[model samples]
Target chain A: MEAKLLLQDHIAKTASITDEQFDYVYSHFKPLFFKKGQTIIISGDKVDCEYFVVSGCLKAFFINDEIKMYILQFAMPTWWTSDYSALYNQTKATINIDCITDAEVLCLSNDDREKLCKEFHQVEHFFRWRTNKGYIASQKRLLSFMNNNVKIRYEELLALYPQLYNLVPKHLIAAYLGVSRETLSRLYASH
Target chain B: MEAKLLLQDHIAKTASITDEQFDYVYSHFKPLFFKKGQTIIISGDKVDCEYFVVSGCLKAFFINDEIKMYILQFAMPTWWTSDYSALYNQTKATINIDCITDAEVLCLSNDDREKLCKEFHQVEHFFRWRTNKGYIASQKRLLSFMNNNVKIRYEELLALYPQLYNLVPKHLIAAYLGVSRETLSRLYASH
Candidate 1:
């Protein structure tokens, strides 16, 4: 499917908009492609745009002082990814986003997003709904981490991205669960 | 300050609205008061409204199957609280919200919020910006949890809620940090 249709379908699920309105909204997005292992965002770099994945996968992650990596999110098709804190607040990115596989995405700049939202009330409604879902997912993830039930967390990880296992490496999955590679192996064995 | 004034001020920071519009928005919010220890929401309850704090504190939390409590958020004055996953999705609450102190709040039903957003473009923009901030904060908390540096988490907690130490009990604070009471005491001693 084309990137424009993908985005339009995603937005239509949340907000009702005419084709002309969607075209106006779509005009603001710039399509970009990335090869596997390509870095889209790096820590300490200015982040101005967020990507809506049209195909393939990308990971938003951070590396601590000890060089331990933690995956914050995986952007599959139709999922949005960015160092949103940096993008929204105009701060330097503290996390990096990179393609896990060769990927295509529609990139929307912060300024353009705000402008579109202002121009179209439905656009604002769509974004509010989008952010609301993101907030709930993040909160749920935080709760899962705090709950410390590895079994439940593993189940949730699978439920969140059933296709992820084939696409992403085990080590990255371990990082995402905040568990050791050994622990992840044990969980996989049990599964 | 009145609940109306508080909400108006908070909305003004993110959006522009005429006094009449503000009044219309304010009308949708029904004022409610709660005594300390009173539960506003519980797991499995149908969640209908989201509260905007006028004064006092509230905690949004979950109790695991082991009966261990984890505090997901502390909603201070000017903050909002609800089982948002339930509120937005029209599902049973998986989390609980309760007052930590005698509190006054303005509650907006999910339907009224949607109605107001549809009626006013600026109202939708305000909510979009509001949810955007919440999404960022939740993501940051998840990153902090994954990083697993207690000292850094403690500092970040303080930065997030300056008056938290004075207001909330130690055990609850420990739960919020996903640490034991002894560990919390040690962190306090170091501070």
Candidate 2:
């Protein structure tokens, strides 16, 4: 699907906007593509733009003090990803985002998002609705982590991203579930 | 402090609104009070309104399949609490919210929030900014959990809610840290 159409479809679900308004809104986004293993944002760098995944997969991950990698999220088509804490606060990124596969994304800068929200009421509503969903998903993720049930976590991950098994490597999925690769393999075999 | 004043001040930081608009927005919120240990939202019930704390503390929590308690968030004064997933999706609550101390809150129904956002662009902007902060906080919380260091989690919790130590009970804090009471006590003594 075209990036514009994907984004338009996403925004339309929450807020009503005319064709001209959508064109104006879409103009603020810059299309970018990355090959597999390409880093989009890295820890210690300043983050300005957030990506809307148009194709392929990307992982938002963090490295702990011990240098252990933890996958925070996987961005698939129509999903958004960013080191948002760094973007909103103008702080250095504490997380990294990279392509899991060759990916195309629409990048929207912080300034352009704010401008669009100010310019269009529907845009503001769409953003609010978008963030609400993100917050809820994050909260659910937190709850699952606190529960510390790896099997349930594995199931939830598959449910969230059904295409993930084929698209994402087992080790990456293990990192996302906070389980060992062997454990993920066991879970995979069981499923 | 008055609920309206607290809310108006909070909104002012993110958005600009006329006094008339502020008053109109304020009218939608209904003030309610709860005693210490009172339940506001119970798991399995329909969730409608989200509570903005005027005074005292509240906990948003979950009881796992094993019936173990996990604290998701502490809603202090000026903080909002709700089973947001349920409220947004119109599903039965999967988490419960309760007053940790005698508390006052201004409740805003989901319908009224939508109405307010539609009526005022600034209100919409305020909510978008509000949810953006929430999404960031939730993401940070998830990251901290993924890091899985109790000592660091304890420090971060204190840093987030400085007055929480004097106000909240120790066991609840332990629950938030996903640690046992003894471990929290050891961390407390070490600090």
Candidate 3:
């Protein structure tokens, strides 16, 4: 499916929008491509756009303690990823986004999103609803991390992403699960 | 401030509302109270509603494999707390929300919240936007846990809540930081 069709499907799931409304929404997002290992946004730089991933994968990572690197997000197809606070707050980015595979994405600049919001009421509401869903999912995952067992969490990951094991690297998945690489390997072996 | 006034201020900050709309929105939430240590929602229990903190505090926690408690959220004044998936998905709750202090809250049944959404366009949009913010912050924190050092995380928490130390217990704060209580104590003392 084309990107617009996916965007429309996402909108229809939440709220109704006319063809004109969809046009206004589409106008703002510029299509872009990135090669693997491309840095979409580097830490300490201003981030004015949020990328909507149409294809391929990306990872958000940052340096810690002068010796270690930590992965924050692994953006899969259909997922939106960015230094969100930096984009919203218009501050220097705190995280770096790197394409893990060659990618096709819709880049929605903060300026264009704001303009669309002002020009179209549905656009504003559409984004609001989108953000809310994200928030709910975020809270759920955080709570699960604190509450659920590793085995349970692993099961959830499988349920949520039936093909995730093959799509992403095991070590990165381990980092996302907040487990040691060895533990993840053992979990994989046990299964 | 009175709970109604607080609710009004919170709503007005995001979107302009008619006085009638305000009253309509307020009426959907019925005031409820809970004493300290009360279990608001238990694991394996049905979750039919969500609570908005009008006064006091609560912690949402669950038991891990080692029979240790891991806190997912510390809901203070003006915050909304619940096992939202159980409430939204009509599933059994995985976490228990317990009062950390004598609490007063505005309770909204899932049915009532849906009705509110159907009746008022703005209310639905407002909540959606709030949800997005929540999602962003949650994912950001999850990433921080994956990437940032405990010191950086603690410092960010301090900046976010300058007086939270005095307001909340250190153990819960440590849990929120994804750190051990002993580590938090050392970090606090060093700072």
Candidate 4:
């Protein structure tokens, strides 16, 4: 699918806009490609753009002092990814975003998004719903983590990203679940 | 401060509106009062509104199968709280909201909020930035949970809610930090 159509379709789910308006919105996005294992945004870097995934997968993650990584989000097709804290607050990124698979993404700069939102009510509506959905998902994830039920968490993970098991490597999935590779293997075997 | 003025000031931080426009926006919010320990929305109820805190505090929380409770957020002055997943997706609430102290709040029904957003571009912009800030806060909380540093998490909690220590009881503070009363005591001693 064309990246522009993909974004237009995603935006259409939340807000209605004419073809001409979509074209104007699409013009603000710059397309970018990355190879598998490539870093998109690194910790401490200044982040100014948020990416809309068109193909493949990306992970936003953090590494603690012990050097253990925790996956924050897996951005698949139509999913957005960024060190949003850094992007929105104009601060150094505390998390890194990198490609889990060779990827194509449409990048929208912070300035362009604000400009587009100011220019079009529907565009503003689309972004508001986008963040609302994101906030809900983050809260859900937080609840699951607080509950500390691995089985339930695994099921919720699969329900959120059914394609994840096939598209992502086992170790990466383990990182996302915050489980040991051995524990993930046990869960996999049981499944 | 008057509840209307409080809301007006909060909205003015992110948006510009005339007195007439502010009056129109203020009309959408219904004032509500609750005593300490009063429930606002319980688990499994249909959630139709989100609250803006004018005075006192509220907690959004969940109880697991073992009946252990986990605090998701504490909504203080100028903060908003709802079972956002249920509110946005029109699902049954999975979390409960209740007052920590006798409280005054301005409630905005979901439909009214959406209507206001459609009627005013600045309202849409205000809500987009509102959710943007919320998403960032939720993401930060999730990261803190994943890192599992009790001292750091305690410090972050304090920084996020400075008045909480004096207002909320010790046990509820422990619940928010996901620590035991004894551990909270140790941390307090160390502090």
Q: Which candidate is the best by lDDT?
A: 4
Model 3 Cα lDDT, one tens digit per residue, B89-111 = 78999888998889999898989
Name model 2 segments beyond 4 Å from true: none
Question: What are the models' TM-scores?
Answer: 0.98, 0.98, 0.88, 0.99
True contacts kept of each: 0.96, 0.95, 0.72, 0.93
The 10-residue segment of model 3 chain B with minimum total lDDT is B128-137
Q: Where does candidate 3 stray beyond 4 Å? A: A115-125, A147-152, A179-181
Pairwise DockQ winner, candidates 1 and 4:
4
Note the clash tally of each candidate. 0, 0, 5, 0
Q: What is the lDDT of candidate 1?
A: 0.93
C-alpha RMSD by candidate, in order = 1.0, 0.9, 2.7, 0.7
> Model 2, A25-85: lDDT tens per residue?
9999999999999999999999999999999999999989898899999999989999999
Can you write out model 1's per-residue Cα lDDT over B89-124, one digit (the tens) per residue? 999999999999999999999999999999999999
Model 3 Cα lDDT, one tens digit per residue, A89-161: 6789988898878998999998887677656566666776567556666766676676646777777777766
Better of 2 and 3 by DockQ: 2
CAPRI tier for the interface of model 3: medium
Q: Which segments of model 1 are wrong by more than 4 Å? A: none
**Could you give candidate 1's per-residue lDDT for residues A45-80 as a string of tens digits?**
999999999999999999987899999999999899
Q: Residue A114 error for model 3, in Å? A: 3.9
Candidate-wise lDDT, in order: 0.93, 0.93, 0.78, 0.95
Q: What is the lDDT of residue A146 in candidate 2?
A: 90
lDDT of candidate 2 over B57-148, digit per residue (tens): 99999988888899999999888889999999999999999989999999999999999989999999988988998999999999999999
